[model samples]
Target: MPRILAIDYGQKRTGIAVTDEMQIIASGLTTVPTHTLIDFLKNYFEKEKVEAVLIGEPKQMNGQPSQSASIIKGFATHFSNIFPEMKVVRVDERFTSKMAFQTMIDSGLNKKQRQNKALIDEISATILLQDYLRQK
Candidate 1:
């Protein structure tokens, strides 16, 4: 089976996660600058067999779309143009940052380590991927 990937997209950076070949284990892959996202994905896809890409959908508490929704949509459009064969899906990403921070604390990360926003994004992506696996 091919691996499924997940993205935690932010304004400045995007986190990436991928499942194993069997699509059972999800792991953090890396974080990249938003401007370099397409290039990064191009290189990654060139080397790996990805089944689909899962993007985070951040919505308001009242279920309205968040301000970042449009940004994600633009990225999705550009991504599809670049990799039309790869499937793209969106998963609800509310509270993922908070969950990542708590996970950092639970994992005994030092204060300095927890301060890395990039790490938080990567972990958030992992969490999103794990949630997706559970849903499947």
Candidate 2:
């Protein structure tokens, strides 16, 4: 069975998450540099069977596209072109960062660990995947 993948795209780093083969549970996979995202995905897809890719869509409080939205959209386009057979979808990610922070706190992460931006990105991706699952 193929799994669902999620991405939390950022300027410097990108977070990756994946659901179980049955698509029942979402888990953080890794965080990679933005410049290396495509290569990372290429290697990952070669090893894992992915049914779809879900990317977090950032938006402002007024529901307008956030500054980072354009960049993410560009990446999404490139991703589609690279993996024509893979399905890609965008999901609203309004407060995922805040939610990630709270999750880390609840998980008992130390202050330093909580401050790790990569960790935050991974958690945000996990949250995004979980949200997508709920919506489905």
Candidate 3:
């Protein structure tokens, strides 16, 4: 079966995650520059069978769309235009950064490593994918 992919989009960098071919387990794939995200996804889709793409939807504590939500929407629109056959879903992403930090601590990452924004983004993507899998 094809895998499900998740994206944690950011202004500077974007995190990517993917489920196993069996669609059982989700794992962090990589972090890429925001400018190159489309190219990265294009190459990835060409090499891998991705059934769907789940994007982290940033929301405020009160459930309103966050400032970055607009940016994400724009990206999603472009993504849909490029890959019309692929399914796209949005998953709420509140406190994902804090969760990612805690995950790093639990994983025994040092302060310096934990401070890496790219790593945090990757972890956030993983968390997003896991949550999506759970919902499924």
TM-score of 1: 0.97
Per-residue lDDT over 1-136 for candidate 2, one digit per residue giving the tens place of the 0 to 100 score: 8999999998899999999999999999999999999999999999999999999889999999999899999988988999999999999999999999999999999999999999999999999999899989
Cα-based TM-score, every candidate = 0.97, 0.97, 0.98
Q: lDDT (CA) for every model shown?
A: 0.93, 0.95, 0.94
Question: Is candidate 2 or 3 superior in TM-score?
Answer: 3
Error of 1 at 42 (Å): 0.6
| CA RMSD of each candidate after superposition | 0.8, 0.8, 0.6
The C-alpha local distance difference test score for the whole of candidate 1 amounts to: 0.93
Q: Can you write out model 3's per-residue Cα lDDT over 44-118, one digit (the tens) per residue?
A: 999999999999899999999999999999989999999999999999999888999999999899999999999
Q: What lDDT score is found at residue 100 in candidate 1?
A: 95
Error of 2 at 50 (Å): 0.4
Clashing pairs in 1: none
Model 3's TM-score against the true structure = 0.98
Query: What's the C-alpha lDDT at position 25 in model 2?
Result: 99
After superposition, the stretches of candidate 1 with alpha carbons farther than 4 Å from their true spots are none
